[model samples]
Target: MKKLFFILLILNFAGCTSNEEVADRSQVNWQSIEKDLQSALILAEEGDTINIPGGYFKFEKSLLMDDKQNVVIAGAGMDETILSFKNQNEGAEGLKISQCKNITLVDFTVEDAAGDNIKVSDTDGITFRRLRAQWTGEVSETNGAYALYPVLCKNVLIEECIAIGSSDAGIYVGQSDSVIIRNNEAYRNVAGIESENSNFVEVYGNKAINNTGGILIFDLPGLTQYGEHIKVYDNLIQENNHRNFAPAGNIVGVVPPGTGLMILATRNVEVFNNQIIDNRTVGAAIVSYELVAAISEEEAVEADETQAGSAERINSDYELDENYNPHVGNIYFHDNNFQNSKWFATFQHDFGKLFNFKSPFNPPDIVFDGFMEAERSPAEILCIQEKQKLVFINLDAPNDLEDLNENIAPFVCD
Candidate 1:
């Protein structure tokens, strides 16, 4: 029995080494071989990395990555690799990752798509690093929905990417969890970064500037089922200057532009340590639509019309049903900096009024309390004479005055 066990252990060690060798051999150079897109697709198998060299590959239709695993499609760099789908007719997406796992798409620029720049659905463990997706043409019709969209995926990381001129959103994630979007730049789009019906999402260290809407967490009635448990922290969400870019029939109206950060019907959302500045409209707007208002009005009217001092009082009878009522619950906004906003901040409905506003945009003598005091951080003191209020912003760390001057000071219109 001891001899048999020793032989089994040796065989297992050899098998592991053989598997590692096979994995190393699977890596191939796509540029070394000359093949068309169709033949390249045929040659690509599981655990293969296709390196498209620095050139343009014109395709008639979208390149679909369907039901593959451990596949990497990379390029030399963002400036080098170009996938142009100018004549794509059917279901336009520059690259679609569907029903796959452990996929990596790095160092490429996907431009001029007939549809979305890159669309991923039902995939997991995906990383998009140092990529660029934009519309090359000034024509309004050339842009598409989302530069980088990961839907129904888990464990996604998007870093050092630039998304410009997307008709719908620069980066969009729906029905996903455990997503990290950091060190990305987005501009000239509808929503800079949008997450709908997703949970455990952290959007930090991003610059969302000159887009229509800076950053949005929304849950539309028809499209998404629920939205909860999101954190937006330390993002430079500023100057979303574009107009609404959605086509006539899309559902982007759920959260429109001129909104720096719009959280609609979402619960347990935390917004902290963000520098929201120079937006054309409201810096942060939170509201629910007509459904909640109608319900509240009906309850108020019924209470007003009831008889006085009766055993069955109308106020006691005015119980709101949780099914139809969509209320914003447990939203915590702490330790954020704000400056040069058009409307400053607007909380539309009564539900949004429940927030504890501490250390508002009042400068000169700025008060830092709550989480701001706990962290012992500096406050942003705006000393302009013309503005209505002296804006005092809270920060989690010491502000680099030089970096702030480089980015925000030059763009200050006033």
Candidate 2:
């Protein structure tokens, strides 16, 4: 009986070891794969398709492509082809494509990148379809800044993608024009599905959930372009209450947890036909750059006081760009559903503290900071179609909310 037991234990241990060996064999040799893949990309002609087979590959350096036209880099499937950069020693991205035209990247998973998972710049036409980008381990400040990053590109289409665990943004389209982001799921990041300083963007049919903030349309100062003519509709912006894990000094670090669909100092935006629910802090917020700037200044001063010369405090002479407009106008929200939990209040950031101070019992569904350009009329500046018994507030922040107005009478669109 003792001999039989010993034989059974030996068989079990061997089975476990064999499984481990099989898992190790699933990952191909990185040196050979890198040499062949890089050679193929460098020697590929126009209208070429580079196919990556089904395997887990590790890379130490970025895969780069430049000045190619009508090229397609496809993989077996998003889950079948995994590119991991956990041990990367060089470069800022897993895959970098620059100065290309009509490039398409589809059906691959890029994870644990040191910087961004995939970055494409200066391309006329770019498409990211059915791709997955994520960080494998804990969500923290060390995660990549963006999962799918496209900048200075025209005719961009990002659809059917999954982005997760980015420290900054899950899907960030910056300084681009004519963009469409649809049917994607973004979660566990600082900001999910963000468009910054981009024009003519349409964000629809996407799920933005479990991030610090969901669906941020922001136009910051000192950027080359301003966001305008934006449309956000038919999206599930819900439960984006994930703790902010962005690195220090990033603009998104100021975003309070539990925020959903925050629009900061952008104009010509239309929000309609969406389900915004269960966000704890606030449902939809329209605020100016001054709000963020003030919070950033306060944090900077606090840091300087604590660390002494580690950070610089903003002085009186500091100035924003002359062409940059700090006020938001021509904004409209309609036909959207907003809901928040009554028991929860955001206390993670300064903005949430202010919300708790003013509306302690229940946070408002929609909030406007009441910072508008003096030259623009009220009608042209803002509009909201009152549906779903929306709870609205005009913060009257210009007058320090002394005249805090909860009346939607003046804001209802005619």
Candidate 3:
């Protein structure tokens, strides 16, 4: 009986080895396949890999991967594979992946798109790794929309990416779940990362610098209805100073100046452990109406009405909700280091009523005498006449409200 059992185990091991050998032989060498853009698209059948060589591919029209499954489109590196689109067609994205599953785009760069550089819409199991997208033109020239946009997708990951010189947001995601965006850098854009009508998202370990607004979570008009349950932590969000130069297309180019982290009609959002510094304008602006927050008693409201129904409705609802008080809720900012900012560290939900381009807005009442006084342990200093009456708070304090308030009081005045 023991000899028979040994013989059966040997047969099972030999069968497993034979199956592994067959699987290895079945793999495809994508390099030997056609390198033409049209041929690559044709070869992208189920469970196939397309390896793009190191070169530039100028596309007259947009390249699309629509409704495909289990396709891996990879390049040698971000600097090697370049996709350049010079046409300024309306709604033309450089590389669009729509309604697909198990799609992976890795190690490539896209530049000069008329619309979004890379857009993924209504897809699942997508991953964009080591990708770089940029739009370069005069700051006054109106380019397209976001650089990297993923909307209404699930199980998505955007990691080790760089988006620069976008007319709109560098990276924008909307109405998506189970997403992770990390180790990315965004600069010279409208907003760094704008997410609306999304849930279960994590944004961390990113650097957003020198954009109009950095790291925004807005749930305003003309997108999905409402945003909920988002987390943004440990990001270096700073120096978002680029103004809106993109021509008006979507919600981003239309937003007025100096609105950072615009949170409209969003809920259960947590922002913590971020170094928000030198924003020079408003940081974390929230605006919403009672309708947006669903505070008003529900009365036969259509889904279209709840979300801005038409273009006119989008404009009018946004205008009417300018004074809406019920839209802001339970926003928490804790353990953040703010420095040399030109405006308020946190402009509350009602900030729009206070500050506008033509009007003056009063700062919050909390005052810090100076940096020395702001710290928990006041630093010993040589007092001078120039520094007199300039109340200094201690920077060493765990929470230096006094210093922060004193520094911010002058600008908050209406």
Question: For residue 399, what is the lDDT in candidate 2?
Answer: 88
Candidate 1, position 228, lDDT: 77
Which stretches in model 2 have alpha-carbon errors above 4 Å?
1-32, 298-318
Cα lDDT tens digits, model 2, 1-414, are 111100011100111121001123233443226767776677667877888765677788898999998888887677667678888899889899999999999997788888899999999999999998988657988888899999989999999998988888989999999999999999898999899889999999999989999999988777668789999999999999999987666678777898898998899999999999988888998888786776587655554454321111232122547778778888999999898875556787766777777777787788888887888766578888846787678888888778877887777886
C-alpha TM-scores of all predictions: 0.66, 0.88, 0.67
lDDT by residue for model 3 (255-276), tens: 4344445555565666667776
Q: Once all C-alphas are superposed, what RMSD does model 1 give against the true structure?
A: 16.4
- What 10-residue stretch in candidate 1 is worst by lDDT? 3-12
Model 1 / residue 360 / CA error / Å: 18
Query: How many steric overlaps does candidate 1 have?
Result: 4
Off by over 4 Å in 3: 1-35, 87-91, 221-225, 248-250, 253-260, 289-314, 318-326, 341-414
| Model 1 regions more than 4 Å off | 1-35, 139-142, 223-225, 254-257, 289-325, 341-414
- Pairs of residues at least 3 apart in sequence or in different chains that clash in candidate 2: none
Q: Which one is best on TM-score?
A: 2
Error in Å for residue 66 of model 1? 1.0
lDDT agreement of model 1 with the native: 0.59
